[model samples]
Target: MSESKSAGEIRLIRLDRIEVLNPRDRGSRVFDEIVRNIKAIGLKKPICVTPRFDANGAEKYLLICGEGRLKAYQALGEEEIPALVVEVTDEDAFIMSLAENIARRQHHPLELLSGIRQLVDKGYTFKSIAEKTGLAQSYVKEICNLLRSGEERLIVAVERGAIPINVAVTIAGAGDNDKAVQAALQGAYESGALRGRQLVLARRVIDKRQRLGRAAGRPSTTKHSQVSTTTVIRTYQDEVKRQTALVRKAAFSQQKLLLVVGALRQLLSDENFVNLLRAESLTTMPKYLAERVWPNGSHV
Candidate 1:
């Protein structure tokens, strides 16, 4: 980016004039800390913003960075907050915001995963994401895998700090094998990676995950269909009738087959019939047919 995009004149911008391009949710505790810190020490740094114009050609500031600080300022009931009015494009501003987030030394696991997923959505490869976020490529790939496979339970548990990322990855790597996942959890507990409530919580999460499957937010409360019991009985009765017809047809076919087989056996028993078949070179028959025709004979 050019210097013009990096550096901008400080200006007091109205809170209403600033539009948050992309809003990221920060944890309440962290936001509280930020608010307290700023309230005590005053605003240490100015927020970054890019000038944007609305359809009415009215000047507006699109927020590029410092969302938490901006929110803190709003929480402080400040009318006009100091902002660095830059000249970067929307895409570049978004990139700068993402870069600012990735540059943080202490990112919450949920935030970290969200950042990596955002970069992946922006068409960055695993290697590129690793480089951009200063994370290992393998770790980035695993994070992406977790997102791709919709491992919502493991992800939510990780977000809530119930389990570490590595343990989650290990359990997820076990695939649908409930036994392997149980073994992994046991190992985690036995190795002191998980203790007491965490181990219990992990086990509970896994059990719920296994029984209820992955959930994004609220669990589904889909009720049974409103079909009447009488309707079900009638449908089942129809199916049974259809099946009975099939069974009757099968029995009739079997009886006819036995009659044919008896006739064939009687014919084969005749020496004159065997001689005629040998004359026509039709002496050989399928092994099944031979077995049916000559039950006691050594057809083999």
Candidate 2:
């Protein structure tokens, strides 16, 4: 340790002597890339730490940031690594760490949550966290609330980009009411966050989950022989053919009906044709047909 240097000075520090105050589970892929970068070009930035002493009066360091860099150094078999030494209170250390995590362009989602959690556990307000991390105060409050309330699934979904944060928040407050969830989906559609195809799929998934009582598909205990891909494709093709035929037949019927309605409307407009129909007592017709033929007047 450089004993004579003031705060914010860079120096070499032994890895064993430093402790990571806010250790996060870095994603393996990201960590491997970090190792490769440091191994290739050396560390671009030094890890930041605050100096302290153990019970035996031996000097030590509490890690403020740069956990990836430190771990990469260890992975490369380096005993000591460079560090940015800072002198600050415990709260200040936590704030600085949060800032560092926020500044990182490629950190894991859970790592972000971990850093925010540490700050919250230290009793910093959401406003303070927002100011330090350059996030909206509402965003800070919402995420911290999720962390405190044990909404782990929602938090992970939002952080990992599986779901929008607002959507998760709506779900969190929805409770056991299906109506609320539906309304939330409606709102997402109105806001253009959920498109038509996504909405259709979402509803189908939700309905399936409700009917089947689970989120994931399981192996069927009452299965017959395995379905061959060729058989499945044949069945699908047959269904498509059947649907196409039905659609064409319905369209042909629609055109015939339109001609019939148009002829009926023209005939009914003539007083002589109307009198003949009345005299023959063939005056009644289906209400829908009547509406199409004589929309304003009631066709007896």
Candidate 3:
């Protein structure tokens, strides 16, 4: 029998020669950024690859890591780049892919979740996934808990970047993807307030209400359906009057207490005020005056 090749003995290969097993095509922005960087700095990192053995026992190489980088290099029409052709089992190949993905400078939480979930689906436990991927088991558990939250469509949306992962997790836990999706779709489809920040706020509000056992619906009580200008004006006036009343009430209460303080101070003899001031070690006249002016613990 031929000597089995280990990972260390694997050889470097040309960039264009290796075939990509899996391709990520969702985000153009990521590809664009990679293209820009490669154009500026050139290839600084080698794509991790695995040797493909044919039915006839011929050796071929396939890309395992740097899938995006390989595509970018091909697009740039580079002749050859550095690569590591490691001999690996299928399990080790999967683990290596996971490791390379996690070490990326920017990681999409949902993408990471999906990759780990795939490994788990392939008969790997959270423990094994963590060990191979260099992620903690606790992190794996936290992410896996999301799938059991019973919102498959929301999870898909999160992975696709249509919705944020943080918000998706909350919506998943709320057990009402229909309501959340309907609200989001309508807001984005109908209303002009379909910002990412607004989606995050909506998810936060829904999660908060769900946790508190309260109804999770539109955050604002008023509906977006149109009403008469007269009704709108009336509502606006009512709100203004209500706020004005509160402000006046607060101002009057403060004034009453100030008047009481002034009367109490006047009632105190000047000699008593002077003696109280001398008793305390106040550094400034205003501080001494403030201390002498107020009665101790007496409700105004």
TM-score of 3: 0.50
Q: Write the per-residue lDDT of candidate 2 for residues 1-300, one digit (tens) a residue.
A: 112334588889999999988776665677899999999999998999999999999999999999989999999999999999988777677667777887577655666677788777777789977878887899888888767655555565566555567776776577546788789878888987767666665565444333332223222333374789996996686677667757977999999999999998888889999899999999899887888887787674
Give the candidates in order of lDDT, highest first: 1, 2, 3
Model 3 per-residue lDDT tens digits across residues 100-215: 67555566544565577677677777787677667778656655676555444444445445555555554455464557645654555355444766556555444443333232
Using all chains and alpha carbons, the TM-scores for the candidates as numbered come to 0.60, 0.60, 0.50
- What are the Cα lDDT values of the candidates? 0.79, 0.75, 0.61
Preferred candidate (lDDT higher): 1 or 2: 1
Error of 2 at 45 (Å): 0.7
lDDT of 1 by residue, 1-300 (tens): 232465679999999899987677676778899999999998899999999899999999989878989999899999889998988987778767776776677655556666777778888899877776677788677768888887877887876788887898889889879779999999998889999899989998887666556544432223454578996896686677667757977999999979988998888878899888889988787777778878887531
Q: Which pairs of residues collide in model 3? A: none
Q: TM-score ranking from best to worst?
A: 2, 1, 3
What TM-score number comes out for model 2?
A: 0.60
Deviation from native of the Cα of residue 213 in model 2, angstroms: 13
Q: RMSD of candidate 2 to the true fold?
A: 12.8
